[model samples]
Target: CTIGFGSKAKNIVNEDMVLAKVLRSQGAIPLVKGNLSLGCLSYHSSNIIWGEAKNPWNHDRSCGGSSGGDAGILAAGLAPFSIGGDLVGSLRVPGAFCGVIGYLPTPARNSVIGCLFPTETDTLNSE
Candidate 1:
């Protein structure tokens, strides 16, 4: 799964986020980890990764961010599904670039109480 925050950040696991918790309750297994832009801070760059996540279709191109890693894994057939957080297009951009289905619910439609950085309050205007 592609975690939306940096690995060093607090509460970076799926269990810490409400959406992931719900998914886990429904029988989802996180098999692979994907890289993301630092602190969900950059959408145009993937430089924060240990090794940047490249597009599955074209290794020279970006897989998109901050959820780029999730999209990359999905495109590479490493994961059946992935959960990603988006403030602008973290989920959508990566999915589009990777040629997979990506969904971003309205801010009010889901709970983001435990998501790292860019908390629900931080993105109150995004909806």
Candidate 2:
């Protein structure tokens, strides 16, 4: 799996993210990083590095943003599941566009220990 270059990912972090660790424990091995919005904020999936993420159902349609790659990959049957940050429908929009399940867990149920959300924002507002 190839990951897109989202701005947040540019920050150097040697350790795996908390989500990655949790997934690994369940026997999920992340193959590679997937595409994402430029700044992790966009309704479209286009980026300079990997280009635009298109809907599998229709080439011309958008697969949605930020998590578009995740939805695109899932829609294409590449992976069973994927993790994406959702702030302003980043995950749900793509999931809906791609005709997949986009679940937003309650803030208290999920952890954001290794995430790099904007400092001024509340992690609870995201999924």
Candidate 3:
């Protein structure tokens, strides 16, 4: 149940988990994916794929896709925090490129119910 990167996770957003941290910290669930949409985020839903982050510093090039919006918002100081998914470098790539702190939790530690499914299985495997 993985929504491949690039144009797949293009514009899907869901309600933030009310108890994501509580559930995870208690081990009820390993991880949670929220807050980031390549085209939207908790702070905004601009449906902008190419517009992406303003680079916060660069203002040139894109912050990446699918989760690009989230990365940009976070990096640009729009919000102090955010959550996002990364199937093919959405989180890490833009994070590095935007010069922001992005954390791709340890394997089996986070559960991506939307973009990727079967939280019990790893979706990062290469085809």
Candidate 4:
């Protein structure tokens, strides 16, 4: 299991996130970090560190975002699974573009990662 660099914890050693811990307990190894969107809300995946994540199918196209790297890695068979967050289609968009399944767990269901968005705003939405 690997996490997206864009969402990694800002620690000296880059400590694992909750989801990573769970996966580790299950004997999964944390390998690498994938690239993700700017500020994780731009609906596109790219960064100064890792550069842009291009679509495996068509290099000219984007892999979609925030979770774009997650989908791309899976589509390319680079890993069994990559951790990512899906707020406002972050996961779905990339999954669709990469032709992989991107799932958004029910809010607070698994507590995988902290919401990057401000918590003052309610996350529930009918749209």
Question: What is the clash tally of candidate 1?
Answer: 0
lDDT of 4: 0.70
lDDT of 1 by residue, 55-106 (tens): 8899999988887888989999988888766667788889898999778755
Give per-residue CA lDDT, model 3, range 28-91, as digits (tens): 6433332334333222222433333455666666665445556677777766655555555656
What does the lDDT read for residue 85 in candidate 3?
Answer: 51
Candidate 3: residue pairs that collide: 31-111, 38-66
Q: Write one digit per residue (lDDT tens) for candidate 4, span 1-127.
A: 2133545445344466666677799999977666787777666788766789999999998999977887898999999877665657877899998999887656655543432442322232222
Task: Say what the RMSD of model 1 is.
Answer: 4.2
Identify the superior model by lDDT, candidate 1 or candidate 3. 1
Which segments of candidate 3 are over 4 A away from where they belong? 1-51, 114-127
Which candidate do you rate higher for lDDT, 2 or 3? Answer: 2
Report the number of the highest-TM-score candidate: 2
The lDDT-based order of candidates, best leading, equals 2, 4, 1, 3
TM-score of 4: 0.76
Candidate 4 Cα outliers beyond 4 Å, as residue runs:
1-14, 112-127
Q: Estimate each model's TM-score.
A: 0.74, 0.81, 0.51, 0.76
Give the Cα error of residue 61 in candidate 4, in Å: 0.5
What local lDDT does model 1 show for residue 67?
A: 78
Give a tens-digit lDDT track for model 2, residues 35-117. 77777778788887788888899999998887798898999999888876666788888999899987876664556666667
